[model samples]
Target: MPNSAAAMSKTGMVTKIHTRIRADPFSAHYELVGKELGRGKFAVVKKCIEKATGKQYAAKFQRKRRKGADCRMDILNEIAVLELAKANPYVVALHEVYETSTEIILVLECAAGGEIFDQCVADNDEAFTEKDVMRLARQILSGVAFLHRNNVVHLDLKPQNILLTSARPLGDIRIVDFGLSRRMDSITEVREILGTPEYVAPEILNYEPISTATDMWSIGVLTYVMLTGESPFLGDDKQVTFLNISQVNVDYSPDTFDGISSLAVDFIKSLLVKNPRKRATAEECLSHPWLNPHPHPHPHRHARSASSLDEPETSQSESEPDSPVPSPDLDDLIGSYLTCPGQGELKAGRDAFSFGEPPFPARPEIQQEVIC
Candidate 1:
């Protein structure tokens, strides 16, 4: 895949998958450097390394299609969301998008620490401090701020979608997997309902107008989920869940909700407002006292770290070193999706599927920088 704008024009979309990202090559151009980080219905994400940079990445290889796979549109919709969200630090960076005749390869940023869900769940009885919650809240606000600025609404915003760059001291935070993302205009609001079963706002369930505030509701749900492990509203059935949302059947049991701050709880109440018109903005959320309870100890002395200022990182590894991974035959995966000239080429976000080309040399000036 060439970086030339010509290639972009040829494909209609500016982003195209390079040759190095293909499923099969003579040798492992991009080695399977680590074990599978996670798996989804359509793809399996593996921790990988570019032989040239030795930098780690999470490679999500789309599983080969089987008969009766219902969410093909959803799978490609995720790709479109990734396309719109490329170059944003908070959003998972999509480096390369590859296609075999049968499967899609998405080379994405790897947040080594995994989902923030683990952090939220770590202290069983112990609750997250306001400071800790604020830190994550600010990062999430900044990320969602970017998406909102770009007019993309993340229908699904939860702890599971939030990931950490490092484990112990914690590191940069990123929002990943926008399979349910929707773009909206200033005056427009979506009526169609879409979102995770638990995090969805009341308005969404009622088929009300969706806006950036819809994301705000999800964020509120996320904040509550982070402070406490359980969801605000859970029911035995999907219909029941939707009913709870529509009816705002939120129970703030003091005994059940042990250790959560009243201010945190109040902030969630404000964000989870059934009417999207009244919901808080990302900026407003950042300004909430719950998110910034105390002033910085040394505001002037706290210059941002150089590393922190850099573009988001797409990979992370342990302080020691990761065990080597045995390379596997990508051909087995690629063979199914390889090109057939007579047939239509696979299309993803205006990029046409192409292979059998040479890898583009790394650009010195434009060194790959992690955005999260």
Candidate 2:
């Protein structure tokens, strides 16, 4: 018998032996092609090819140290979160990990279609119809639901973070970038001011404990932008934008949403609620009328604004009679929420009800890179 079996017999208890071997060094299996795909503050994603299988992948090279100190914990935390969500269809898959003397490399799936916003811009005239938006929205919700189910909150859920698998009709999507993701239990509350400015939830601005609702709020903003081609709370600058978000000021003028549907407006309102507890859950969002559209036999579909139909505007005095004074420190973090222009669009088919396979070319076997 093996030594482990012999020891188990001697002790009258089964002793498990760990026979797992470490994977070969990443450089041994893949070669960097010198083509840079994306760049960030501390990392650069480059195109790489596998030596043995000839498969393509995006290699994210992150520095092991920052300012002469170890910074691997951030990468490790991201890895842990990705491992828990590896099986999710909407999340980008992590294939391999490599560590070097001064950097860490992550081999990830390649999303050639690029950001959903790019598609929207490419097909400006025929922007994603309501049905197309529904399908994409459902996919995003599925990914978010998976993250929430695993006790992880994806603090950032914007158009920039959502990627398309191909440039074809109704292309599959993958949620990327989990640098701000946090793991939480049932009773634990996370209180960090993170996430992009226009998309950040009100709770984060108010300094309230954050939960899954934070992501839901972003989803609402994303949905609005996709439909109207404009941000609901985006201001001319950072301070105005932050003030708009904190005050929950939204514009639903007929001019802004001339061709939009009422059900779609309702869906956005459900998510953009100032109170986190009132925000819709991912599961609930999946069942929303906008996502799961029901045919209305009526001949005319009226476009309604949020102020006129759903949430009537209230004066600032009436809204915050007893609210505490704002803090300067929180205001500093709020600056990050400034509007990011030129975030491309999501492309979808005209017929929203048809769930046919997209006519996209087969994707290369390369890992996709997520921008942090």
Candidate 3:
């Protein structure tokens, strides 16, 4: 079963609902062995070891309210989605859940590898090759297809939201943060101005109807970032970036695609079509020639001594929630940002997670998708 986190219905509805969760304190069964792995506006991810098995996991503590706003249902929405996709492997799994006076903790599988954003910016020898990209693309599409099939759209798909099970020699991807996700339905037409600027679909900016094609626009941007290490539509600022995307002003210069395949370029072209109807679906993307299962030298890098950026004191990982004893209050830890290396860098930080901005806030849902 695939899994995800955030507050929303699988059918694309953003409404409040009750969740079945353990109301006991999270510290009763799991010990906070290390530090907070990551944090955002309304949540913090911490490293916890289940007392029962000593198996490690990442516990996300999401605030029930933001700035004195009651939003407990937001947390429940995420749990609901994770619960819905429990069987899909590509999406991260929610091992367990717990509730407290102020927060809900989601125990998840700690991903040993970090966010693919690292690989996108990785240098020289560690750079991802076509084969590596293909492998990742398939996994991403498989997960997306799973979500789409369920009528859910991860409206904010980006490299930071895509995590790897293992970084070295690369491994399967685990899609995270469904706060912005919505379920698509034949009966309802979803429309909203949401998502990270660079990865956002044009229709969103134009205030047009939203659909699965919205996510496809992001996949195109993500693919370009993976192949070229540069954001195709990133402009001087948010407005310029919006302009670039609105006009489909992508740069497919020789320098950008120098060593890349023409098929890869064509794949991106197909997805970046200004018209959402013209963009490829997740299943179609899986069948694109660029992703054809062709043999090539393994591009997954071997493990090496990590640099400072590769290691952080408290990286986010997957874990299930359980409490074994009295735990420290998270007043300081919960809101403070983590430089977790084991889990990955807190990709966006507070600015990214602020309900105010939309590079889709740095998240512990650290999220970009909370459309509330």
**Top candidate by lDDT:** 3
Error of 2 at 310 (Å): 27
Q: In model 3, state the lDDT of residue 317.
A: 34
**Candidate 1 lDDT tens digits, 1-372:** 443221122111123322333446512557886556654334566767878778766666654453344333444445555666565556677766666766666666666655666656555433356556767777687778777876778776766567777655666677776655666765544564444557777765555666788899889877876776666666654555556777778767896457777888888888888878888888666656676555434332111222322233334422111111101111112111111123221111101111111111232222221100
User: How would you encode candidate 3's per-residue C-alpha lDDT over 123-181 as one tens digit per residue?
Assistant: 75887897788777877777777777777787767777787777775766777776666
Off by over 4 Å in 3: 1-11, 14-19, 293-372
* Residue 240 in model 1: lDDT: 58
What is the Cα-based lDDT of residue 54 in candidate 2? 85
Ranking by TM-score: 3, 2, 1
For TM-score, the strongest prediction is 3
Q: Could you estimate the TM-score for every candidate?
A: 0.69, 0.73, 0.78
Q: Which lDDT value does model 1 have at 174?
A: 70
Candidate 1 Cα outliers beyond 4 Å, as residue runs: 1-28, 63-80, 83-87, 125-127, 186-189, 294-372
Q: Which stretches of candidate 2 lie over 4 Å from their true place?
A: 1-24, 294-372
Residue 246 CA error for candidate 2 (Å)?
0.8
Query: Tens digit of lDDT per residue, candidate 2, span 1-372?
Result: 112321121211122322221245877899988556665446667778888988777777777675455656656656566667777767777777777777777777766656665544445555777666777787788778888877678776777678766645446667876656777765555665566667888776555677888899999988987787677777665656667887889887788778788888889989989888999998777666676555334422221111111223121110000000111122222111111234442222111110011111142322221212
